[model samples]
Target chain A: MKSLLKKELSFYLNNPLGYIVIILFAVFANFMFVKDIFVVGSASMRPFFDILPWLLMIFIPALTMRMISEEKRTNTMEVLLSLPVSETQIVVSKFIAVWILTLIGFVLTLGLPISMYVLTGQVGGRIYLPEVFVGYLGELLLAASFIAISLFYSSLTKNQILAFLASVITIFFLIIFSTDFVAGVLPPVLQSVLNYLSPIVQLSNFVKGVIDIRSIFYFLSFTALFLFLTVVDLERRN
Target chain B: MITVKNVTKQFGKTQAVNDVSFTAQKGEIIGFLGPNGAGKTTTMRLILGLIRPTQGEVLVNRLDPLAHRMETLQHIGYLPENNPLYGEMKVREYLSFVAEIKGVSNEEDVSTVIGQVDISEKAQAKIEELSRGYRQRVGLAAALLGNPHILILDEPTSGLDPIEQEKIKNLIKKTAKNKIIIFSTHILSEVEDIATRLVIVSRGTVVYDGDKPKRKGGVEKLFKKLVV
Candidate 1:
């Protein structure tokens, strides 16, 4: 498992795509932070959290789009499956590699809050460090779940484009089902059920500094479910 | 030694391998010859535990492949059809990764296999930059890295030049002296040169399984007689 993780990490580091994802994600997130947090003069990072899920919806897919798909396309999955490693270990190792990469992107965005704190301290307002940290945690969990989903979809096909599209559609639905749009359309009982199913809704609780156990379980369960599916998919493809 | 007992695999309605049973002893080189889509690759995949058999069981070294999995795979090295590799990785890095996964802790053996397969010169080159023949050599080197007791190579010499082909053939012949080697090929003459036994499958069933012909009759003649 360690070897597999090391190989995946090395592959990502050597490829230009990994660097491109980091640079592009940093630029886009910072741009949004400046436009919404600085230009609009908001104390709460609601806008920042608002845009995070969308950014991750696109970015995580790009990161995981070729995880297993390209292996199949190149026929390297056969080589991998034939090795002295179980399917579960292979799936988990690749997931951890992509999750760490996503976490790195989140860590880089910490500069945003630091910049805001400095700017605000120069003036007269409070920094609200705890709220922003909580928000960052929420965003990280959401990104991890989406990455797992993307990795699972990537295993289903040899085409990266198809994986990307499938992930986007799935994440979009997860986001939409959590929004007021679905609540407004559904009856009282159905709305309650749909709201519970919304990953974005679960994330909103974290951004509000609540740290709900239900939300945490939802994110962890979401990730586990997709990872399981990825393992099963790889086994079938083999 | 590898033993396959009444193994059958089906992808929905299309049966890829049907009730295939064979035993390959250690130190024997067997050839799997068949037309396209005739279950050759499917049988190899089943043996490697890449896919599950729909019926019956496949045992490698006295343990069912599906039950033991990694343990059974540790003693086998396989090169799938088309020489699949990580195109983004350098030749040496990819081989090293395979070696690590295959539990080859001996650094010298890794280098020796790379040199033996003639890929040591291109070790630093990325797979995307290498030609078809070079990629095939890298794939072969990876399969040989573990010094596995069983070698399952699918079309191992498909895209090589004459010189490289001869070198690979000779390597296989030398290596098979103490290991079980099963490779699928369409080239009849190549099989004649390397295989000790032949198993021909037609439409998901083994149509021919016997000793290598002592006479000059080609695999095509046998294939026509069985498949046609």
Candidate 2:
């Protein structure tokens, strides 16, 4: 499992296109924060957390677009399955790789929040430590969910483009299901269920700087469900 | 040694392999011969524990392939059909990764197989940069890592030139002296040249299983009769 993880990390770190995409994600992250700073006329993490779900819908899929799909396309999935590695090991290694890449990109945006506190300390701008911590917690949970979702889609098809598009569209629907317009289209009871299913709604709880056990379960269950689906789907092809 | 006892696999309603039973002892090159889609690869996948046998059992080295998957996997080396490789990785780099995945991390195994496959010169080249023949060699080199007890090569030379075909056949001959090799090939001449035994399957059933031909073109005659 460690070897697989190392191999995956090497693929991302060494590939020119892979590293370039990661760098580009960071650049856009900082850019998002800077633009938000101007628009809001204040230094807070609300905008960053707000745009994260959208960023993740695109970025996580790009990170995992080839996870299982490429192996199937190249027929290397057979070779991998024939090895001594377990299915859990392979899936976990890939999930960890995507998580590592996402976290690195998320970390790059740290400079903005820190510099906001530092540069604007003269103007009474304060960085709420607890909110920043919870926001980061939300980021990790959302990333976990998105990465798992992408891996599941990747396992379903050999085409990376199809995997990317499918996961993006699924996540887009999940995000919008929490909105007022979409909620209005459903019955009151169904709307509540949709809001509970929405990652954005769960993320909103974290950005508000509160730790809700229900939200934690929601993120974890969402991640676990998809990861399990990925393993089972790949197993069927075997 | 591998024992496949009345193994049958079905994908939905279609029986990919039906009641297939065979034993591959150590040092035997058992060639699985059939036309395309004739369950050769399916049986190989069964032996490798890639899929479950719906109606029977497959044992690798006395252990069930599924129950003792990782252990059995350690004992067998598989070169899947099409020989998929990480196109971005250098030959040596890819071999090293295989070595790690197979629990053979030492540089010695990597270098030894690189030399054995005659890819020492191309070790630094990316897999996509190599010729078809060389890419096949790299695939063979990876299979050779850790000196596994059993080898499963699924159509190892299907798309190669005559020269490349000869090279793989010779490589198999050299390596099969002590290790068990179960390879699938439609080319009867290649089978006659390399395999010690023949197991011919047609439409998911093994019609013939016996020793290497005692006479010239004998396996061909037998294969033709059984395949159709």
Candidate 3:
């Protein structure tokens, strides 16, 4: 298991993809911060928090698209499966590789919240540190679920683009369910039920400093469900 | 050190390998010969536990491949049909990575396998930068880790220059002195010259299995009569 993790980490670190994703993430995240704080002259990170899901909806798929599909495309999956390792170990290692990469990207956004806190302190204005920290946690949880979803799709196809597209469509729907467009189209009872399932709605509570257990549980269970499916898919293949 | 018994693999309605049975002991080079789509690779895959046989069993060093997958795989090293490699990684990096996963990452062991396969010069070069022959050598190097007792190679000499072919053939001969070597090849003359025994499969069945022919071109006559 350690060997597999080391090999996966080296693959991203040695190639340009890892660096490219991090750079793009830092730039886009800071751009959101500037638009929210500087352009609007607001003390809150509401715009930055709002834009995060869209960024991850596009980038998490790109991060995880190649995990298994590349191996299958090159016939290296045969070598991987033939090893003494179990199917579950392979799935977990891949998940950790992408999850950790996403964590690094999330950590790099510290500058936004830290700057907001410091600049607000300097001007004697109000910026809630607790809410900002909780919001980052929410984003990480959402990213974890997205990684798991992407990992499952990557296992189902040999084409990375197909995996990426599948992840985007699935996650896009999850985000869509939280929007007023979906609520407006449905009855109040159905809207409430659907909104409870939407990660965007669940995460909104965290961004507001609510720290609800249901949202955390939803993200965790969603991640576990997909990873379990990934293991089952590979187990069935061999 | 390897035994295959009554193994039949069915892909949908078509049989890929049909009721094949063979045994190979230590210090013998068994040539698995068959034309394309003749079930040679499929049989090798079964023996390596890459896929299961529909009916029957494969045992490597007396361990059932399906039931005791890890313990059985520990004694055997396999080079799959296509010789797939990580082209982005340097030769040494790729070799060491395989060695680590195989639990033979001791510095001496990795260097020895690399030296044995004659890939030391290309150690720093990326696999994509190497020629087809060198890439094959790197694959062989990966399989040779841990000094496994059984080596199952599917088409070990395919798509190589004569010089490269000769080197691999010679290496196989040298290594067969102490290991159970089962290699599949479609090239008749290549197998005829080196194999201690021949197992020829045609249309998913083994048509012949016995000692190598003592006379020149005798196996060719036998193959032509039996297979094509």
Candidate 4:
């Protein structure tokens, strides 16, 4: 497992994709900070959180789209599978690599809140550190769940583009149904069911600094379920 | 040593390998020959535990491959059909990475195999930048990294030029003195050159398994008579 992790990290660092993801996230987060906090003078980062899921909806797939799909396409999956590693170990290594990359992005966003703190301190006000910290935690969990889903989808196809598109559509629908759009269109019973399935609803509660156990469990279970499915899919292909 | 007992693999309604059974002793170089889609690769995948057979068992070094996958695989090395590699990785880097995963402590093995395959000059080159023959050489070096007891290669010389093909054939023949080597190919000349024993499968069943022919007609005549 350690060897697999080392190989993945080296591969990502040697290639340009990892740096591109970091740069893109940094730019987008800075733009959101300028537009939402500076121009609008909003105390809440609702705009940032609103765009966070969308950015991740596209970015996480870009990170994970090639994890297993490229291996199958190039026929290198057989070489790896034939090595002295179990199917679960391979899945865990790839998932952990992408999850660590997402975590790095979360850590980099700390600059936003720190910059906000500096601006507010000059005016004799305090920055709401707790709320922002909770929001970061929430985003981390959300990104992990999306990475799991993308990894599983990647294992299903040899085409990375198809995997990326499928992940975006699936995550987009999950985000849309979490909003008031579901209640506006569906009956109450169906609306409640769809809302339960929406990650956006769960993520919103985190953005508000409420660490609900149910929401945490939702993200954890979502990650575990997809990882289990990825293991099964790879085993079948082998 | 390896043993296979009544191993069968089915894909939905089709049986890709049907109740196939064979045993290979230590230090034997066997050739697996078949047409396209004849289950040669499938059977090799089964032996390496990359895929589980639908029924029966595969034992490598006296342990079931499914149950003891890691331990069993530690004794074997495999190169799949087409020799897929990470294109962005340099040849030396890729070889070192595979060696780490296979638990080769001695870094000298990497350089030794690179020299043996005559690709030491191209060690720093990326896989994508190499020609087809050089890429295949890199793949062979990877399989030879850990000094495994068993080597399984699927079409090791499919796309090489004629001179490169002869070099690979000679390499495999020279390396098979102490290890059990099994390779699958459609080319009759390859089997004739290096195979001590031959196993031919057609439509998922073994049609022939015996010693290499001593006469002059070559495997093409024998395969035509058996597969026809």
Error of 1 at B187 (Å): 2.0
Runs in model 4 lying further than 4 Å from the true structure: none
Which candidate leads in lDDT? 2
CAPRI accuracy category, model 4: medium
TM-score of each: 0.94, 0.95, 0.94, 0.93
Cα miss at A25, model 3 (Å)? 2.0
**Candidate 4 backbone collisions, by pair:** none
**lDDT of each residue in A29-91, candidate 3, tens digit only:** 888768656668778876788899999999899989999888889999888776677778888
The per-model DockQ list reads 0.70, 0.69, 0.58, 0.64
Per-residue lDDT over A161-211 for candidate 2, one digit per residue giving the tens place of the 0 to 100 score = 999999999999999989999977999999998888899999898998998
Please compute the TM-score of chain B alone for each predicted structure, in the order given: 0.96, 0.98, 0.97, 0.97
Model 2 stretches with alpha carbons more than 4 Å out: none
lDDT of 1 by residue, A1-238 (tens): 8889998888878878898997798889888877766567666677778888988999999989988998888777778888888889988998999988888888778888788788888887957888888888888888889988999999999999999999999999888886777778889898888778888889887778778888889999999999999998877742
Off by over 4 Å in 1: A38-40, B216-228
Q: Which residue pairs show backbone clashes in model 1?
A: A238-B50
Comparing to the true complex, what docking class would candidate 1 get?
Answer: medium
Per residue, candidate 3 scores C-alpha lDDT tens digits across B93-204 of: 8888888778887978889988999988888999999998998888888888888888989898899999999999988887777898899987788888789999999999
What is the C-alpha lDDT profile of model 4 across A168-227, one tens digit per residue? Answer: 999999999877766898999988888998998898888888888999999999999999
What C-alpha lDDT do the candidate models reach, one value each? 0.87, 0.89, 0.87, 0.87
Angstrom error of the Cα, residue B155, model 2: value is 1.7
Error of 4 at B109 (Å): 2.2
Better of 1 and 2 by DockQ: 1
